[model samples]
Target: MGRSKSPVRVITAVVAMAALVLAGCTKPGPSLRPTATTNPPGVFGPGADGLGDTYYPKAGNGGYDVANYDLDLKYDPPTDTLTGTATITATATADLSRFNLDFTGLKTEKVTVNDVDAAAEQSGAELVVTPATGIATGAQFVVKVTYGGVPKAFDEPGLGEIGFLHTDDGAVAIGEPEVASSWFPVNDHPRDKATYTVKIAAPEGLAALSNGAMKDKRSAGGWTTWTWSETKPMAPYLATVVIGKYRVKESTHDGKPMVIAVDTSLSAQVDAQMAQTPEVIDFLESKFGPYPFDALGGIVIDDRRVRFALENQSRPIYSSAFFEAGEDGTWVIVHELAHQWYGDSVAVNEWKEIWLNEGFASYAEWLWFEDKGEQTAQQTFDNSYAPADAEMWRVPPGDPGKSDLFHESVYTRGAMTLHALRVTVGDDAFFKILKAWAAEKAHSNATTPEFIALAERISGKQLDQLFDDWLYGEKRPPRPRR
Candidate 1:
């Protein structure tokens, strides 16, 4: 939960600070191996469907295959009342009659396995089921769980906790776990991402929302039912739910629909503060390709989300951090949107190669700056920021043995590595290399070495030394003459 609690909440911020300094660690499951065809000797592609595929063969009994979900959930901030139902479809990777799903704050009232009441066990937020009939390997089944509780959190808040505290403000779903199942039955982690069809029932006039698109809505029992479906497969952390007294702001950018939902305080005037989004998106599409979703918009929630933005699919959760007037936001915004291609669509195989995401997005920012009258963009490349010492390459971010995703070495030196690549390949071919890299591997993870290979192959130029010196091994290149 890389979110930092406020100074007022300093005592409550035990794990927040540590988590921020160390961006946590998340690894994809083993089932994520590329199809034999897509798996090249030196490269592998993303999930079959683009959203990441996480498989933990030994995490549970026989492992689990999370296919999809029909999630119907609700929370009453009035009494901190949490209630919901989820129909989870999954397959048994191996022969097994029982399995577990993480649900931190949520309580289970009823359980059904394939349309029949079944014996279930509840331990903390985990729900385990013993099917009446032994389920076989690769056999698909349905699990319907209905329950509600005061949504709780894990040992860490933002990383694996589901925040469902009923507050004076409203109820919000801050899911980062393969742990959101505490509030809803879910596979939890990102590599296990699946198509989610969510339904939320809340008091009328209160806005109910979830990830993806809003399909249908109706009032039931003085509570409004919200049906949201994201056909795109998504990890549980990315599967989000938020309900509160909202101020919805609507606008159109480059012909695509855009919406910004905030609390009542800024609902009426959220647009003026977030006006820069369209131009930024247009600028990106002109270079990177399309926006990479059906629509694009922002969700500037309360200050609790801390710094930066969570690029949550078509709708990213932006904190008040970027709402300021004329900050150095161009770099940050471009970085997040570029995640639509790098981190979101084509995710990393594991936490170790986060440089693949951060570096590419940061370099995209420089490319945007270069487009914004920075002398042909190559000057930005020429001025790649780094220490002159050859040894700087060896000292990457994170501790010597422990890797951190946001270390300055990874940020600055990582960006500079892209610059060094451009310098090696020349301008015209450099841009072509980028376009080809993005186009060919549009929705899959790419390793740093794999990227180097793609470029080396395309340019017919050797790149082992480029990746070696700048990325894996830290040795700054020779300083340019003044």
Candidate 2:
């Protein structure tokens, strides 16, 4: 049965490497067509309430494709409040009478469409907006929403807490599967990719960091505003903003920019682990393709509560504890960094297709260690198949149910699927497939079927049964023959 038909259950990773462990973060509007009173009617209607994502039925809205998100936010640590405006520029795919933006908790102060006042209301996580006038299809529209409130992090049933998480000094946005809405109004799904400009202003002493390269910084009235921009298309889930007292370090690796923000508390240990950032990027680029984004870096927040790290576009976010753990921490760092290509660059179209993200990143850990001569991908794959983990076989990587989005199958079994494919296609073709997949699908969303088809085309072999038995089948297939 499809995930949509099934009732939502509110219920609910380790990797071998002997070291590596598993861990597990809006909107619209327009340069809209000027509202018209006269009708040239075909089917002028409101956009779909949801994008109809199988696992996340309410994710992403329909009827429009977002082009860019300009988020101007001010975070006051004293009050723990985030005040800001989200200006979205998008093109309407259909004649839209109204549309919805995914947002939760934050208070909406004002909303505008094409610079005109529009009516807005909150329905669950959906911020439904109705323009004063109907928008025509093929017209570009602009929406600007001003909202403010104490940012709250959400405990996503099985996915852990995410959204805007308060830290010792300030707050960091972690949590995944879909938490961007908690901080800012967004389309809130992987299918909608848009360029982003995040401008954050915080108190004088506190440092605020976000994704991509830092474009500019200005200070006024004892407050500093940092501006960061990601030119490449990005999904909402990959968006991030971190504010705290951090020892911000910047360097260059092979002409690409490298920046690492280590929490002041764990600066010593984090600095050393972060020194490997350049090497990690170079290593992955050698295997996957040229680094997918213009900049490469990360942010380490000082918080033990945030046990897992997030792969946030050009810059991944980490818990300070992750760095203090030593080699295992570095391996985890590599895993998240690898996602800059796998998850951030080659995004999945639906939440159900998350194996495309986690699986690739998990396999990246194997590849990184393989390069270090510590272990082979084959050995890692073989080790993951212990009888103790047999229950993981109950659900294939392709579909692990809604609540099990972060199950071990998506990571271990998902990586195993890739290794199996490598053995079936040979090393040369396998690497070619990896590089091609990242290069071709860079900054766009993709599905499991698209990957299967791409693999078949590149290797010039039938991989249907192979993907079927490994990715979709309930029972695990016999080990691949080398």
Candidate 3:
């Protein structure tokens, strides 16, 4: 969160645009269809994934079951509808409630649990389904959600960009996690994460691709069904899909295949804007853990207008607009890709800790400059925050009891806390702490105290005052004389 982002501003952003796109799923608008911008449905025409497949329950699933999903959906473009189900398989844990699901804008015409009808309710944009027969430990159950709608510009309602913005040119949805939910049902938040098996049915000549390696694509029934899947579990915010008349630019990194997907209409400018995506990927691979997913690639949505780049799991969403600014592309790309390790893989327990996600991502951006063998760490540190602006780190925990949910306290100050720790704990332990954080908490949410404890354990030094001064304290320490 930036200083410009106040709590009132965030509330307005949510109230204005709550349901928007992220990556895998889509959200509906607050309008009555026909009169309002309603989502079209029932894209199931031919060559569907067959009703046998079951969809995974994202949040409300009973028990603490963590498993990957194999989603097979069938929908049509002409009717602006979808007609296919999903097959979600997972292990059920004892300590749990119902799992949450992100259904995007799809109006649930029908839902079944283990082939039995499950009752669903429409609260706001989500379709809440309480599973029947309940769930037990080690038990496996299948859920299927079916519906459809026109894709909203992949964005959240409150703070949104012109998603699928129509320039003098064509349209592409290039925002982050918000966009995915615009057209599909998925897990809305990051805490509960899973792998995705994506299949999109579009009219002929339209191309579709997602975060992972391409399994198979076929054309039939006057529509083309493109199916892609990821091997690792990713946040719902990172599971992405890019649909357009796209041309694929393929490459390889560390023996894995990569692609830069550009909509055919925008091919002329691809050479200029996307030229550095591969380079940025190479830089990130060297610093962070290995590229998070099996494949590395991106979908070019807006040629410009986007401020932040989202490391949408494997399929990163790039802004066509920022191609002209060399520094903008450098910082945003590195920031988002760093999320591959900090934000994407090891996520926040709740939305309040979004700073833990974004701040670290921003830190990763500065670190990118350091790794380029150009800037000094102190120079980068100074560049990150000037003298008086250091108060950014004073934000309280998002526990609601502690501090505001979002404030510059999270981003600038979050990074500053990390920087302050680096100064206090020394470089060796600091870097080791980071790697240990990633290695230990992969696929789980992390809190500020958890990070603090890890630092103390690794450095063999209790950082009680350091933690207080940097993280929990109400006032920031005076800036060290430059």
Go through the candidates in order and give each one's C-alpha lDDT: 0.57, 0.79, 0.55
Q: Return the TM-score for each candidate structure.
A: 0.77, 0.91, 0.75
Query: How do the residues 385-459 of candidate 3 rate in per-residue lDDT, one tens digit apiece?
Result: 565544443455333122343345555566666777777778788788878877777766666667778989999
Q: Alpha carbon lDDT of residue 114, candidate 2? A: 95
For each candidate, C-alpha RMSD in Å?
8.0, 7.3, 10.6
Better of 2 and 3 by lDDT: 2
Q: What is the per-residue lDDT of model 2 for residues 51-137, given as tens digits with 9 covering 90 to 100?
A: 777888878788788889999999998889999999999887778889889999899999999999999999999999999997787
Number of the top-ranking candidate, with lDDT as the measure: 2
The window of 10 residues in a row where model 2 has the poorest summed lDDT is 3-12
Cα distance off (Å), candidate 3, residue 171: 7.7
Question: Per-residue lDDT for 1-482 in model 1, tens only?
Answer: 11132322321221122232111112233455222123223332211212232222211122466778888777676877777788889865545545666655566788888888877777654567766765565568898888877766543433332355343566665533233554676655444556788888888988877766667889978888888777755556555666777776666676656766776654433455455667777876776666656556656565544454556665666555444433333445566676666566655554456666656666676676667643344554444443355333566521222234455555456667777777787777677777666666544444555677788877778877766767765455553221
Judging by lDDT, tell me the better candidate of 1 and 2. 2
TM-score winner, 1 or 2: 2
Error of 1 at 395 (Å): 5.1
